[model samples]
Each structure stands twice: as structure tokens, then as C-alpha cells.
Target chain A: MHMDFSFSYYIGLAGIMVFAISGAIAALEHKEHHHDVFSVFFTGFITAIGGGTLRDITLGNYPVSWVKDENILWAIFLGFLLVIFFPKLLTKLRNELFLFDTLGIGIYTVLGTRIALDHGVNFFASALLGMISAIFGGVIRDTLMNEVPFIFRKEIYATACLAGAILYLILNSFSTNGNMNLVVSASVVVLIRIVAVRYNLGLPKIKIF
Target chain B: MHMDFSFSYYIGLAGIMVFAISGAIAALEHKEHHHDVFSVFFTGFITAIGGGTLRDITLGNYPVSWVKDENILWAIFLGFLLVIFFPKLLTKLRNELFLFDTLGIGIYTVLGTRIALDHGVNFFASALLGMISAIFGGVIRDTLMNEVPFIFRKEIYATACLAGAILYLILNSFSTNGNMNLVVSASVVVLIRIVAVRYNLGLPKIKIF
Candidate 1:
């Protein structure tokens, strides 16, 4: 039980870092001269926390994740501090946002699947919940930014999370050890996202005419 | 039964029109000399449909408000057309936006309260949901424009919805007739909003240190 809780904690932290970075990058892109460091930091925090918060609220889990653990708050704070102190330097670095975002996505998907499975949800529902936990924050952030949701536009985002969630379920049937499952499931999400980005694989857009 | 459905329908239409006009006026206020028509139109549509759509989704109603009724769609379309065709004229008539938006706040709150009541939710939960339904869309629009959510800032927005919803429950206990009850509830919301805005009444902000 201790192992499971800590594993989820670490994975969730990593996910927050990634989502925050992505949000920061997006805010930077949106405003050329408006160096609103506070806005960027707030956006990052929202992006990281938004999806899981939605999942928990919908599932009737109160007190929320960041509220429960001070570590996640520190992570967001440090991330914001890092960006603020080194805005141009961090923004200039190539692929850092992508790297962290991919890692966060994978880790979050595994954590979500684990939580749903622990709650005794069915496989399909678990997978869907996992994907929701992973992608909904980005969707919320993008929508609030007046842009089409990132999941609806680019990258293999939702699909990547769903695939990883399904893979976690498959891995769990073969073994019940908690740590191995976390590693394996997170690896599945990470690998899929990496390959998808490399090969430029994504879902075909639904063309409304 | 027919009167109940028709009353809900008209209430929803009024909400949509008001929300759209509010968005258009907001866009006009955003820039003094330059008007971005597309942004205005997009914001208008989002404002019009946003609150009710969120309400339906969170309440687990599928296909959402606009999708469920074609008349709602037509209302949105007509609202959009009016704003798109007459941006300057619409901007000049800004008082109409407040009247319409307050009316929308009332109608949507009642509609949301009704849906929750129909679903057998508790009074407090129903009232809270009603407020969320009425205010969330405008919160969203403000956030997308990179501003603080309006409800969280200067307005007694959510409070108006909650007050109206409370009145709804109180009236329901006194009367069993649904149509009359709904009309009374909606009127209560509109009046509350108008009075609050006119008197500059709002919730006290909490200072966290």
C-alpha cells in the first residue's frame, strides 16, 4: 500500500512538472512582448493540475491532489521560479518542453489507470479515465487561452494516454506487484508518445463541412 | 407538460441571446479603435452556449444544451449573425448587453436548477449547479481573453444564480405547479442580478496570507 501511494506521488509530480512547462511555453508563444511572468506561471500551474482535478471532482474525490500534498505545490512553485528567473534562457532551450510534457503525459496516464483500477473500474472505463486524467488539463488550458484544445489539434495526446492505459491493464493481468506495474505502464505511455512524436503519428481530424 | 417544456425552451433562448451580446460588447471594450470581428463572433458563440453546455455535461446529460434543441442552435446562429453584421451598432447599444446578460443569468440558473431538481438532487447541490450553469461560460470567456474570471472578480454573478435557485426551492415548497414556479424562479434571478449590479453589491473577497 505504501509502495503504491509513493509511486503515484512521484509519477504525479513528474506529470505536473511537464504540464507546467508546456503551459509556460504556450503562454510565451501567445504573447510576443507581454512578459507577464505571473500569467505564464499561473497557466503552467493550471495545466498541470487541471485534468486530475477534473477527474477527482467528477469521481467525487474532494480536497484535491495539490491540496493533499505540499510537494506538488512546491514543484509548481519551483517550476515557476525557474521560468521567471531564466525566462529567455529556458524558453530558448529546444525540446525541453516536449521532453517534460511527454514524460508527464505517460506518468499521469499510468497513475490514472492505477487509481481507476484500484477503485475497481472496468478496463475500458479505467482507460478512458486515465486518458481524461492525462489530457483534460491541456484541453482546459487551451480552451481558456481561446485556442482550439491541444488534444483536438496536434500530437497523439489522448490516444497516447488511452493506449498506455490499456497496456497497463494488460500488464496487470500478468502480474500484481505494484512497483513493476507502475514502471511498465509508465514506460508504455512514454514509449508510445516518443514514437508517435518521432513518426508524426496522430488521429485523422474530423472534418466538419 | 407542454407549458413546462416551452417555458424551459424560451428561457434557454433568452440566455443564449444575452450571452452572445455580452461577448460582443466585451470585445468592443477590449480595443478602443480596432475591432476584431472573428474574435468577437467566436467569443459571442462561446459565451452564449458555454454555461448551459457545461451544466448539461457535469449533470451527465449527453449531447448538451445546444445539441438537444435545434431552436437553441437557431438562437445562437441568429445571435451570431446580429453581432457579425452590426458590430459598431451593437457596440453603441451596450446597455442592452447588461439587460440581456442579467436575464440570461436568471433563465439559465432556473433551467439548471430545474434539471437538477428533475434529477432528484438536493436543494443546495441543485442551487450550486444552477449558479455554475449560469456563470461558468462568462468565466470561461474572460479567462480565454487572458483576464481573471469575471465571477471571481467584480460581479455578484454566481451569487445571483444561487439566490434565484434558492427562491426556486422555496417557491416549489409553496406551489406544485411547475411552469409558474419556473417563471417565478427566473424572475427572481433577473431581479437579483439587476439590483446587485445597480447597487454595486458583491461578495467580500477573502485575503489569504
Candidate 2:
């Protein structure tokens, strides 16, 4: 059995916490007067794990990480409770949301790519898996919240993930150390996303009709 | 490896067709002032396979149902094209939609329950898996359309799937013939759902604070 307190696992737990915070913020935005704790927690938990669950499934990895790892589940609940008690801790909601989402995609993309490679997927498919892992949680969260997925919006969100994932794969092929590859690839995603949001930049719209 | 052609596979393909039609109908409902073919096809295809895909993932079934089965992909496309070319074929949209959805859940619940059992899940989890396979496709469809999932509404929808799933398991425990169990269990789901929708029946509401 793998050690429970691995540094890698802790980093993944931190990513889950970040995603749960964003999910809770969304739930808070869409709260009905009749909403309860279950609704909030379920949304947050699902958002925290949706992407990785999908990635593992796609790669035929068994036991999906959260099922065997109770700490991961705890991290999501902790994140939700943090939001519930200190909503003001996430003041500047829009900016903080963007930051959290960027961190989430950055971390997940690199991690997902590595896992997919370990599962023996081709480089291209692994990169695609990375992008899927990074963005699908938000896609699911928006769907549950009755909104068109944020990924479908006019933003550089998914593109940033795709770029970073591909970059990670390319860097791996260059014999760079794994730590350097992860840091550089994830930072590229974060920097691109930050700049895009700052300048309201996006891909050019096409009139395909 | 499973055969290229099987009675069971054909039945699943038919269910895919039913789900895709409903998804296409929803896409048609929500068409923008300017939208394209890709959007419609994607929405329809996703709806057709969404439930089964999730079911297999949860069971840790490999390659998923649609991924390795080219014919399954073809079935979804056929369903989408049918709707695209002849929207009028599904006139009286409400009744037809109910019929299609009811038929879909009936077929999928039994099949999914059996698949989950084969994957060694306990009885309760198998029943839950059956309901998941029956409902999640529509759940995904509604989400993608930026609506609250239909199953979350006041309805007998998920309950019908659950009852049928439990019935199938009970019958299987009695050493009932496989075909007999499949037919009877699926018919119960269809009959109950049809009656519920006809009479506007739903589970009683509880106001949880």
C-alpha cells in the first residue's frame, strides 16, 4: 500500500481544497432560500473530484483515487466548511475565483498528464487527459448549477490547460527533471490565464453560421 | 473479447438512439439565433452515452461502452441525424419525449444492474448503479442545456429506476431465468413510470431546514 502521507498526495489534496472552494463559491452564488448543507457539500465535493475521477476512468485506473483515500474527501469538506464560516476569507470574489481556478487547472493538468503516461497512454492522449482533468470539474460544476459551462464561455480557460499539458509532455521528452517540468508547465498555464483575464483576451470569434 | 455483433449490443444501441433523439430535441429547443451542426450532434451524442459511460466508470469497466464500440458511436449519430432531418417525426413532443425517456430508463436500468453485479458490487450498490445508468444521461443532457437536472425536480423518475433495479436483484436471487428477469424487471420500470407521468405522481416532499 502507498504511504498515506506522501508529499504528492498532500499536493493533490491541496488541489482538491482549491477546487472545493471554487465549487462552494458557485453554490453560494446560486443558493436558494431553501438550500441545505447537503446541497452545498455535494456540489463542492463533486467539483473537487469530477475531473480526476474522469481521468482515472478514461485511463482504466481502478479504485478512482478518492474512493480509497479518505483524506481527499476530508479535504473537500474542509474547504467547504472554510467557505461557510469565512465567506469574507474569499473577498474580491471574482479575482480570488480566477486565482483559485488557475491554480486548480495548473496543478491538475500536470498531475493528470503524468498519471496518464504511467497508465501507458500515448503522449497526445495523455495531454488530452491532462486537459480533461484540469477543466471538466468546472464544466460539471457549472452544469449542476444550471449554467452553460464556463469552459464554453469566451475565455482562454481550456486552451491554457491544453497548452500547459502539451508543454509538460514536450518537456518530458527533453529529459528535463520531472520537478522542473511540472513547475514550468503549470506556471505557463497560470501566467497565460492571468494575462488573458487581465486583458480580457480570447480567441477570435468565427461566424460559422 | 466480446463479439462484434450480439443481441445485447443491439439493444444497447437502440437505447442510445432513444437517448440521442431526446438530446437532439432539447438542443433544438435551445438553439441560438445562430448555431451549428456540431453543437447539436455533440449534445445528442453526449446524452446518448453519458449514463452508461458513468456507470462503467464507477464499476471500473474498461474501454467504456462507447469508446471501443464503433457501432455504438454510429447508433448515436444515426439517432441525431434522424432528428436533424425530420424534426416533425417527433411531433407531440411532450408525450413522445416521455415515452422515449421511459423506454430508455427501463432498458438501461436492467442492463446496468446486471453489469454492476458482474463487476462484483453488492446488491444495494448495484441498484444504485442501475439508477445511475438510467438517469445520468438525462442529467448530463439537462446540465449541458444549462438547466437543473430533470431528476432533481419533483418527479417519480429516479424512484422508478430504483424500484425496477431492486426488483431485478430480488428476482435474480430467487434463481429466476435471466431473460424472464430482464423482461419483467424492465416492464415494471416502464409501467410504473408511464403511470406516474400519466397521473402526475411524485414522492412526497419534506421541508428539511
> TM-score of chain B only, all predictions?
0.86, 0.91
First chain TM-score, candidate 2: 0.91
lDDT by residue for model 2 (B29-133), tens: 773311245445556777888898899878778767765556766788888777766667666475766676687789789999998988889999999999999
DockQ of candidate 1? 0.05
Model 2 ranges with Cα > 4 A deviation: A1-53, A62-134, A141-146, A152-209, B1-4, B31-36, B92-97, B144-146, B204-209
Best by TM-score: 2
- B3-51 per-residue lDDT for model 1 (tens digits): 2456567756877887877776676678542557677777877887788
- lDDT tens digits by residue: candidate 1, A1-209: 12235756775686697778666666656633132444565567778788876776566453345544556767876776666566666656647766767778887887777777777888998888888888988887787666788677787868878988898888888988967887777777878888888999877778799
Model 1 Cα shift for residue A80 (angstroms): 24
Q: What local lDDT does model 2 show for residue A41?
A: 84
Model 1 interface CAPRI class: incorrect
- Per-prediction DockQ: 0.05, 0.15
Superposed model 1: Cα runs more than 4 Å off: A1-111, A114-171, A175-209, B1-8, B28-38, B84-92
True-contact fraction for model 2? 0.22
Candidate 2 residue B135 Cα shift, in angstroms, is 0.6
